[model samples]
Target: MTKFRPCIDLHAGQVKQIVGGTLDSSTDALKTNHVSLEPAGHFARLYRDHDLRAGTLSCWGPRTTRPPLRRWPPGQGACRSGAGSTTGTPGFTSYLFPEGKFSQERLDAVLHSLDGDKQKLVIDLSCRRRGEDRWFVAMNKWQTITDMEVNQETIKQLEPYCSEFLIHAADNEGLQKGIDETLVQRLAEWCSIPVTYAGGGRHLEDLDLVAKLSGGKVDLTIGSALDCFGGSGVKFDDCVAWNNKS
Candidate 1:
């Protein structure tokens, strides 16, 4: 059964939902859909109360807003924090780094930082379809198209250094169009470790679809489409219920 995972995407230290592709180095290029006045801890507590674990807390841009959002809240359900390549804040069980430039130095730095503790690490991978309908990893907050293709070879290579994988379909993220079906199936077939797939989830139905497509191997996260995020496509309560039932 595919479980419904929740998320808190923090940009500039505030809780907000933005188009994944719009995240870039420049501020003006950003396209935001919802900005929550409540701090990131509020959502963290919500997830905790709902027992929504294995969710993602992603930092969108520069660390202008300071700590606490990307810094996972203590005592909350198990959540992964992805803020910087080398920094793992308090309460985060793992460091979910963005491999933006595909540099050996960057990979080595993360590996060295782990110091033989690969279980406390994760790689946040977002990919877009390009030539011949293949998924190639996008880096730099899903703005840069890297040469890294997310295939068995890549998964095999990264598996030695991380406990699991978190993938976002950058092209459909926050659009609420639909979950990336191909990516879900591919991830289910390829990943040996527990992998979570997020993007284009418009309703509770996508959860069932993901379950069927991935053979219940992939977990999901909804953002802009959720009722809590100023969208009416999916109800947060319904997702909670779905998780409980499944």
Candidate 2:
């Protein structure tokens, strides 16, 4: 069935849950749902102790501050997060994989980072609707328009690089309305690797619906609605119970 994966969204070195679409240049417009007083490493250790795999580490920082991530210990953490800048971070370059070629040195660093066993890599296909039921992956903090479409072909091309796919329906993300059911269904049919869906999950039942719709091939992440974050629609303990049962 659909398991509840964990997530730690970092903004300015703090764990935060903000409206997905509002993440643009202006920090003043952010609709923050919750900002944890706990440090990012705390959540990392918590998830590690719980054996929560497929947890995401989305770094919304302007610069790559990896000391906190290192404190989490990559050995003990089950996270697939990215740190990027519009221009690019120095050591951990923000540019896309081989596609967004900077220098050979930078490209090598990016590729080498994803090295190891197949399960080490997970590609994030954060996207928005293009037109007429069509969707395209968004880049550069979901601001730049990309021609890359979220079709079987796109997944197939990315399959060689990663063990799983993490997709956020950027439009519906953090809205707590409902999931893009069509997108979940489509991803289940398209992806060969494990996939996780995040965005617009307001209630606990949405997890069941996603499990049913994707035939248990997809997992869910609830942010604004979870009690741990701030809102109170879905209790964090219940999500743990659901995963345990599954």
Candidate 3:
């Protein structure tokens, strides 16, 4: 069944919902949709109260000023932090250092470190459409495009090394124009493991749309569209209700 997975994005020590493509090295290039005054712990507790599992607490930019994740209240559900991996292999060992430059040696190191424990890893295959009907993975805060194509071949090869895949449509992310149905459908067809698709979700019906399009195989994550995140398109309570349906 399709579920509403929640998210809390921290950028430069503040909770924010930013347009994916607009994020880059230059601060002026960033386009932010919402900035929450409440701390991350607030949303963490809220999701716990609702029993929302698998929610992500992602750090969008430099974490120099960001508070340590430990300080946040527990019960935020299982979190996958993707920030501060620039120096060496992250403690999590899932995210790639240098943010999306493809290196077979680095990949092998990560895979070897896992020692066949795939469940501890989740690959972020977020991408952008290019050429004609092709999607290439975007990296470096979505400013660079890698040569890897997000297709069945890639998914099949990586499936055994990772437990789940988190894909965001970089071009449509944070636009609230509706999800890339083509991308969602392709993900459902390609992935055997659990996949969560985020970006361009505008309404509650999108949840149903994803369920129908993916046959309830792929879960949806609505960031800028949820009311709690300063969006008016969908109510947080309604999503909870949808999840609670018998």
Instruction: Indicate whether candidate 1 or candidate 2 has the larger TM-score.
Output: 1
lDDT for each of the candidates?
0.75, 0.73, 0.77
TM-score of 1: 0.87
Residue-wise lDDT of candidate 1 within 130-236, one digit each (tens)?
A: 86658887766676677678887888877777777888888898888898898899899888888888889998899999999999999998999887888889899
Question: How far is 109's C-alpha from truth in model 1 (Å)?
Answer: 3.2
Pairs that clash in candidate 1: none
Candidate 2, superposed: residue stretches over 4 Å from native? 67-77, 83-94, 97-109
TM-score for all models, in order of appearance = 0.87, 0.85, 0.88
Relative to the true structure, candidate 3 reaches a TM of 0.88
Q: State each model's C-alpha RMSD to the native.
A: 3.4, 3.7, 3.1
Model 3 Cα lDDT, one tens digit per residue, 1-246: 889988778888889999988988788999998999998888877887887877666666776343454533564434554333321222222245344555656666776776746665667777899976689887777777877888999889778777788888889889999899998999999999998898899999999999999999899889998889999999999999999981
Better of 1 and 3 by TM-score: 3
Better of 2 and 3 by TM-score: 3
Model 3 residue-pair collision total: 0
Q: Per-residue CA lDDT of candidate 2, range 1-246, in tens? A: 678988888787778887888878777877788999888788777777677766777777465354345544556646656434322221121255334322435434445665534455556777788877788877665766566788898788767656777888889878888999999999999987888888899898988999999999999988889887887889888888788888
